[model samples]
Target: MILPFILVLALFDFDNVLLWTHEISLVSHKIWFCDAIDIFYYLNTRLFLLFFYFYCLLPPSTQPQRKNSNSKMATLAKLLSSICVCVIVMLTTKAVEATPTYTATHCTNTTTYAPNSTFQTNLDILLYYFSNNISQSNGYFLGITGFNSVNAVGGLFLCRGDVATTVCNQCLTTAIKEIRQHCPNQTEALIWYDECLVHYTNRYFAVDKIDPRVNLNDGNIVSSVDLGRFNQSLHGLLNDLATEASGSSESKKFAAGEVVVTESMTVYGLMQCTNDLTNSECGTCLKNAIGTIPNGKQGARALLPSCNVRYQLYPFFTSSSPSSSGGMKLGPGTIAVVVVVPIFFLIILFLGCYYFKRRSKKKILLPSIMENFGDEFPTLESLQFNLATLEAATNQFSLANKIGSGGFGEVYKGVLLDSRQIAVKKLSKTSGQGTIEFKNEIVLIAKLQHRNLVTLYGFCSEEQEKMLVYEYVLNKSLDYFLFDPHKERVLSWRERYNIIGGIARGIHYLHDQSRLKVIHRDLKPSNILLDKNMNPKISDFGMAKMIDIDEHQGNTKRIAGTYGYMSSEYAMHGHYSEKSDVFSFGVIIIEIISAKRNALSLHSLDFDDLLSYAWKNWRDEKSLEILDSNIEKSYSYIEVIRCIQIGLLCVQQNPDDRPTMERIVSYLSNVSVELPLPQEPGGFMGNRTNQIPRDNISDQRNNSNTTGSSVNDITMNNSFPR
Candidate 1:
């Protein structure tokens, strides 16, 4: 591979690499012939190379070798030898070090346009615009040209999201000029390059398929001993990229990141979608693409028309670029898929072959890592209950049995034949989780066990009726007690204090103790259920993120969870971390000690939020004043003040300043531990709505305390939650 690449490098003079040759010279003539076959000669054209070698080997007959009068002929022969060397070196270089590897080309052979015809002329015009129009300073362009339906044509070019505008323009120009040469008179054509793709047809896309995927492994192998770890890290990285990238907009729907797979290796990955697909559409396409990435290899990638994804052991992306892409592919099924000829000095290396995946299905399901666990997951028989058993327990999912409802579906209180009470969570048919992803999450959640975390008893998957069975807690949820005036008394000072400790411990376990590091993205009062003793048990693993244990932060455009509880960094920007969870814990702690529902800590003249009011009093050296008046007799003033200080520490404006759960637990256990001074927190989030995403923003209603206010308060479950 190294030698061949070096040869190709020697063959091309970069000065003339882009310059086209019309008249024939040894170099020009050979290049012209090779290009007609393909700019890259369809990647190593065996037949053409064999013929060229034989033709060039045969000596020019009857040469005037010894005649002084024929000195010009000998000089010409010497020049010819130099040209052949250059071409051979160029061929090797073409394979080795070229940028923008070609994936595939799709042409609709269903129709053709005659040379010099009106349609052909329109296509030429469209192609001209795609290659020449680069002044906008972005890497995407779309246009259509033609007077009548018969001569009409449309075209669009997409450069890799992470590429420089200059690189983008160069790739587009080459793709535009070459697609025509490869497909010739085809009425509709598409060409793919690592840097860019040019697609043009008379009709615009309506229903896009996730099919004709391209899969490539860079021929590097992972050892058997390290294969399992490699696959696990790769899968987690790909899924994270998909979730992050899918939240992006159409102009540059892509993401790039790296994850450490082994002690010595870090895998880099990039995912991208075409500029036309919806956010959900992009997600589905990326999920499908991620599922197909090659396994047990040092490098791999999968490409689709709607989205593309790739990963390599050695870093392959520009860390500075917003997104980067690479992979190999060639597949069959489409009528006019063209493998371009090699001679076109502009030829790109074909990275891999393609396999057909039809887009006829109505619903797009998430792909494999979560879709199929295979042997790694425990069998469902031991964890599944029949529909009849659950139906009888919940009385046919009756409203009387229904305890709560969230974005996912309804949760019901049920009893098993053994008299064991259970929480039956019926998943909505339209929920984003498919059967495979649902089951996968269930398995992962079941493995996690802590007294403060809700327990998954089992599951019920009878056709479309998917459900999760959790151990039923008698006290309902934290919000029911914390928010309702009549019920608030039951949560005495001791119970509230214990609940705070338990919540912190549970989150700590999730972040550090569990085999898989899970980030409970939606952490709030409604999702925290209490057992008979009022012990807090966190619920809802549906929208939880199970990331690489080493990963510390994640970002997404589709923000889940209640707005008020979300950390400012997470709410305004899509960034979250274990510290984000600490921020929510801070809010809960303050709410408990103050007996003030989160929406309004206390109705003051200033209309300050819970955090702001608490911060003000604490800054004035009145920390004990923030405590709930109702707990006057039962609460320890010193302990309550300490809790307030911790709460303020957790909700600090800077996430880095917030204490970790481990430290919070330590603070709660040891009374003498000195705490840091608290700073004023961010104001009520009402005015900053513009920065947050409108989609997936959840909260049942605005706060009754702040009427006509723009605050996102009175939260409800808005995602897959129990």
Candidate 2:
């Protein structure tokens, strides 16, 4: 895709054009170490063509396969969303700094391998693979290296989905370089960061491990007169995000928003999981993270490997729109012109070449691919419906029948001959493009029969199309109304409360009572489909891997997210369980209440936290948006993410969220208690009200305990001296 562009640059005497072309020519053959990935990684993508061309030229082998992929349209939405904002990040050049903030590392001293041994050699190979071969397009990678099972090593790297590509690359580079240094000759090393997380082992690494996390807090409890109300607001925000984030695309398991406690005070929070994780895995990780938020603290964080959750009085996460301080956001139209047109042109350019030669795209028949699945693939026999039947039921999914659309796909209202009402979700994808493995293991979701959960009747997988059939809910999605400013009637407070209870009931059934014990990973308003009585029915079972089952794909296992308040054993050896859903549940309720209060300019920044940036004034004015009539010093929502913007540079998290490693993160949070406080405030550092810029924030109230805590963090997995 970029070869033509490179040739054009060659005539103009661009210094690197000739060199890049020679490398691109090798793609027809098996290749290793292509410069295309690098050129794209560090390349400033202001000229949208450059970004489009890079992906167009990206080797098919390097492109990530879809996990729990429902349809192609949803995937394309995620791709475009990330690419457009990443273009903004590349232009700003701020997300390139700081990054890969260190949280904790676990090295298995008990399982040490001698120098130059087979195990050590395997570990080296695994690290090498991570540094050069991981996909920059995604924040998560899982791979294993070994000639034999006796000495194999497995590793995974996951950057916060919001961070820029450069930040992800840099974070991986650091993890690869220092992980060994941190635990020489150890058989295991699990290093977690604010912006990203990395872990590898010569032993087992399952899809979920909630353990050995670092719990940290500013130790300043909210001394407000209504502490309970403040907590309710905070919990309400996170809980909603947890539900929402779990339902997010597989490529991004993250959600953030703020809860307004009063005109002068607000609570900002975020929940995230590694993209490799299933919906249940992400929700569980976030739940655990939220559970340990150290109730009543002015600020708190649950930092772990599977998922992470945090909340602060001031802005701790990045909101939309650039602050006066750093970074910049481009309007959607500008992004379209910059990123879309070039892509459209490139598609045409490739099509012409393909028609003259042969069909450039290869189509894989669904039936043929299904034959390759082993016995482990669940029986789709009775649960599988034919594509033609669905088309007939939905009238070929005509516009009149189309009830809704999203990144996921179109929801068409359908009626069967038996007068049965249904909703047909059609997801399209290109055959022979990207990994095409269908997660048949998810058949359990169809068995999830509950009153609060939308029943999954069956599925249809055909050429270029994957469809899910569900019991139709007449009221549409909760967000369809919650986020619409022009909706005529407002939801009654009692209705809102009932909706929350109904959602809780659905999740409770999935987690504790349903025949299939699963987690409804995406629990946000959009996935909460309301029925006739305004009772909530959770749809889109983005839930997780089945419990007590050993799944194997290649030599690796899926991995993800983190948070704190871990047991000593759990802390020493990373293993976690379900988090209290209370914290995450709190935020959604607040959004339900303040649906009309989200008219901030920052919303134009295009990040997805629906109830965001309302607290832009809280960063500096300390929620004095009312008391301080002058509004002189109040800044915007620039707390951005992963807590290391103070100890670490600003790049480890999503570039869209962070300004270019600004010296001042804001007066929202100070994470000096965990990481070394940077002298220059080298990255983002927002503090709370009544808090100062003094460097002693990291010096915990109990100095003696703090030092030991930091030291023990490194050897948490029983690597410490007895």
Candidate 3:
């Protein structure tokens, strides 16, 4: 075609032939070619063909043989057609090579290496190891190579939660091959397939990374009669799955389940994390992933380095081996007669009846609960546990089950009949204030729901006994880790930073998102529970207060809270607010960073308290020094300094000087935000001469003489009585 077009242009004029030839060359080179080099190759080949036709078949200077010219033109057309067919075949093959089963890929553009370079060589070995060895396991593998940090390569691959060994192996093989092809010489790469994910990096990346995640929506809108109900059910199902998946063993961190969105509809969900991540890390990653789910979508998935979560109206995961019809494949007649048509409605009826029955019981308990307290009561009857059941679960309040005790009472580790674990807080009958606080905790936590907050399983109130059942956190409290010299090593700077963020999110939920505006009166390290994965959940709401959503502050005549964590106004004049929680959060932040208690003895003359020490360091521009030595060089320097400044801001003597939970969250999340200088914190007694005993100071604020400190208030010195 090009040869004929050039000949026609030449018949018009030699200049016209040259102009048309240049125009075709320019367009074809720019639009048809893949690269500059490819364009040059295409242009040179086309030009050569044109040169051969003009010079050999029919010269422009002398053209007389008509029959010969016609034959040559016919031959040129056949040759060009053959070339076009070959080019199309080659392009198709390249496209096929590029396509993979994976949904997304992350190849680092910032870092690339030469072919067969040291880093590339190490990466290739790691990839080969993963591809060959990952399939040998149930569904997980981690590999590392290189003798030094610079040349080191660490990578991991995880199959979807419910896939079998064979399917996992196949997916792993595909992922390994595809990632290497996609990333080529890049030092870092990640690829996610529906069945598995593969990741590799030069730096150590076994720890959880929340940001730089991939979010995908199926784009199919949920045609639900009640969108709100569907969303609620979806989130609830995902949350439950996250909890289950995060708590899974190190070898397998995966969970999948289905929840009824309505009487006739069900949403299937799945959550999984890299086996190497801690339960808390998995939980955090899943929670972050869940948060990114866009509204009005019927199905969505978010993939992070450590964890991923997915929810869909249709089943996307295989329950058994992939060979078994790939997924939950069902026939139309079977589906209509069985699960969806008949059983679904029956399940809804059963659940509705059960819900109403529980609600009725809660109503019965409400009057009794409010009779003496004379305050508004939340719906607590549903959370009620049988007194006998709890007694049995805790071995009739046996000494062997007791975990800790405080102003509220003793906490016992209890196992329910179904094998579920719980932390049972039995309020002391001797302490009248404990009863009030118990009532307070029941109302506050029942209405609040956040991943960072400890779950209130149920309560038991029968005769003289009142007990609160909470989801048992396996690793106990942050203080157990932060205060113990030997255990402190486990609390890495990354983990500590995560804990700080989790605590911040929990408090923010209490202040802003919860149905009630709550102030967690005792926000301290001991009050923060760490799950198996070292994720922090704020607990002990016994001292918490509930106020109107519009109300900014509250005044309490009976100030009952820990000394070091209490804000100045709340401690000195019984004034409390969300800002008060912020102050305690500040103190907790300093403790988390420094691994030092705020109530440290001043006898050493080094520092009066954690706050004073933090403030001094920040003022001196030596904020990094305030970080716990256990963290060493692993910490993000800017994040540590920002936290220090934020902590100081929260503990400022004047309540007005403090940032709200909303602002604090923004500050913590956005690194670009500039922070104002912090004023001196409360109880900044400067030196040993002015330092006061925290116990005396606390006693002065609340002289109720509660028999024992709260379970959280019990330091290592306070041993449990046998």
In model 2, what lDDT does residue 17 have? Answer: 34
- The residue ranges of model 2 lying beyond 4 angstroms of the native Cα positions read 1-99, 206-209, 320-722
Top candidate on TM-score is: 3
Residue 588 C-alpha lDDT in model 2: 41
lDDT of 1 by residue, 1-722 (tens): 35435434433435534322342333122211122223433333432443354344434542345455456444444434444455455556544333566777877778888976656655765665565566573887766766345667876788787776666777777787789787878877778887888888877553246454557778869999988988888889988988888897546888999998767778889988877778888887887776676678888767665678888776555556322222233344211223433433222211100011122121342233224445544565588788877875666676666775644566787655444668887777776533433664586777798898988888876655888888877776787677666563556888888998899899999888899888786677766888878889887765567778899888877565564577778867778788888888888898888767554221233346778778888988887777777777888777788899999998888888998888999999999899988776752252334234454453333323422212212223211122
What is every candidate's alpha-carbon RMSD to the true fold?
28.1, 36.2, 32.9
Residue-wise lDDT of candidate 3 within 418-480, one digit each (tens)? 446688888788767667767777777777788899888878778778888888887767877
For residues 405-440, what per-residue lDDT tens digits would candidate 2 score against the true structure? Answer: 433345577654334567776553532211121343
Q: lDDT per model, in order? A: 0.67, 0.51, 0.71
Measured with C-alpha atoms, the lDDT of residue 33 in candidate 2 is 24
Off by over 4 Å in 1: 1-381, 433-441, 600-607, 683-722
Model 3 regions more than 4 Å off: 1-368, 372-378, 486-489, 600-607, 684-722
